[model samples]
Target: MSEADARLQDMELPTALYESTDDGYLATALTIGPWDAGLQHAGPPAALLLREAERAGAIEGGQTVRMAYDIFAPVPVGPVRITASVVRPGRRIELVETVLTAGDERPLMRLSAWRMRARSDGAAPEPPAPHPAASGPEESRRELAAFFTTEVAYHRALDWRFPTGSFNSPGPASAWTTPRCTLVAGEPMTPLQHLLVMTDAASGISAVLDWTTATFANVDLLVSLHRPPRGDWLGMDAVTTLGGTGAAQCTAVLFDAEGPIGRSAQSLFVEPR
Candidate 1:
């Protein structure tokens, strides 16, 4: 393995994304992204916040039904703090909010999740539509390596396979992704945690414009799950649309090997690279 790849493989983040400090949680290189050399990717922070939310106010027999996040600033790749609280509590449902802040107390991102009790009367409605056949990762593993020239810590920690589209080209796409590393060291991730990590890839998987000359950074992410995702593989059938203005959106139908589990949407700020 390359030096960077070796670092990614043996990083301390396998047990937890950060080490607890009196002030807050410390950031790690594993959270780095390709957007800005000093900024962190949206996935790790989102998952970390969700982890806190789940710990603070998780209901028995409940699953995360919806999760929404708003990025207020570029999340720094250094020490950061997370605060979580229960907004609403109930027997069948609950709402929790988690906020991330940098060392300067500047807000980085805010996330809210809705947890609902699971119910199955043997009459659950049929899935809205059928998803495409499963596509193995080996098919596009080599292509993705060539497509992404920048070395991102998050991308190296996961295995991505595009079955319907090329990452070098732009358009609607379908891909299956699996996490190769844990969000928090030693702490096992729930199904919801696993899904949240992969949801942030919507924009990259379905790029509508040339990535070399333009940039599309998602400012917000919203994901809703009808049922908890199953298995290790998470499938995203994604499409990105850019308006005449600088705004754009990426939407994806989420799935596991079993079937469709939920949907995710991201609002992007398009600009020149």
Candidate 2:
């Protein structure tokens, strides 16, 4: 799933992103992307899948170290069927896969993750320091993505803070984001859920192509973390490079208030709208 800052936490979003029901998970308006109000944004649905993955492969002191998502179809803003299974079961490491179906039918996406045992006794080098000019959440400019719809949607669920370029500026960009809403109706977001929900939008905040004239869709998302992300604020220092053959890729360094935590990448199918 894809899409914020820490004291922005003070401004918690008014509603949850999705609701649970006997049939399946019901996506709320918050799940809508700007591109299509009828279709769901990739981020919230990604979070739903990851949440199931975490539950299916629960282990003591375990954490998801690496996660990947493959989108087979655009998610719709309706009931979603989710199923999770453990692919490889182990004590130290495990692989869990989750599949999402639209209205209990079409398989819309797949999520796979490696859950690893956590340890306190470890020796490692410190995370690299932020750039001298790296802007904190409060220091950055407040700029939302160019929404195809003006009504509150997925982009409105989070606060955006850009220290570098913005959606309109193009090229590489860096931003700090904080979610305003809870991932599920009744649950407080876990560290993993918090990260996955907003991590997929790495491309949107750092788009190299103009949104009005071009269409760039991320085919897949890959995230590798050195540690479990913490706090309410997460930052992405992202770069996108376009290829001549109608392809593009975005790579972003992920961060929390403490420092760098991990990285996320997306491969894009790009063309003019």
Candidate 3:
């Protein structure tokens, strides 16, 4: 990995084990960086909750799972409780919900993850035309450094290249990306996790009246995963729209070699810079 990538990889939660008390509750404390939003930190905490369910034998092999997180409040930089409960346990599918609460038991975020079994057969669709190659990382990184605040901690888990040139000048900028960090211990970093990371990077270029378009924080994020990520190289083609009222939105359709894997949308708060 490059130096920047190595730096990013080292920032993730290094451990999964959570300390439990006699009451069987797992709680831990964390510090959030200035640029770190709640959603970005939500994934690791949610994963920890899932692992807890696994250790308790609530979920097993040969099953499929789906997970979602609802951000209730900004994640605090301190101790919080992560709790998991099984909603439905089926022979082939399992439904699980996890919650992270701050001190005094106020909800910070809630996640509902699904687990299920795989089918033996499936149909095939024609593949899409290939995207043009992206630009080198060194160039893209320099452009990114100009707008994004250097203070926020960014996990360099992925290598990103932009084929279309700098987003700072305007128009379409496409990025090809791959993970530099090793994913969670047993889980192979599914498409869900890929979407979780790449979805937030879509709005990096536009300039809004309230906030700088570069490195905008997402107020809400939603991703629809259509297929498993087939290759290490994934592509993101993003566009931004600014409203007269001073807010903005960015949408990016993400793809892998097999085809269009999924798309992501973000609602952002902006003010004139």
Whole-model Cα lDDT of every candidate shown, in order? 0.77, 0.83, 0.53
Model 1: lDDT to the true structure: 0.77
Name the better of 1 and 2 by lDDT: 2
Candidate 3 stretches greater than 4 Å from native: 1-68, 77-81, 88-95, 114-116, 122-125, 128-144, 165-172, 183-191, 205-216
- Which candidate number maximizes lDDT? 2
- Judging by TM-score against the true structure, name the best candidate: 2
lDDT of 2 by residue, 1-273 (tens): 123334334554448889898967888888887667798888898889988988898677788989899999899987888989999998889999999998648789999999998877567867566632277898998886665474467877777888888866778888887877888888887767877778888888778888878888998999999888888888888888898799999999988888888999999999989
Candidate 1 lDDT over residue span 1-273, tens digit each = 557666645544433445667877776665777666577879888888888887777687677889999999889877888998899998889999999998778778999999887777589687555555246555544334333444555666567787887556788888877776677665566667777777887788788887768889899999988888877877788899989699999999988777788899999999898
Candidate 1: deviation at residue 273, Å? 2.8
* Candidate ordering by TM-score (highest first): 2, 1, 3
Model 2 error, position 131 (Å): 7.0
The runs of at least 3 residues in candidate 2 whose Cα sits more than 4 Å from the true structure, single-residue gaps closed, are 1-14, 124-128, 131-133
> TM-score, each model?
0.87, 0.91, 0.64
Clashing pairs in 1: 14-185, 15-184, 15-185, 15-186, 16-184, 16-185
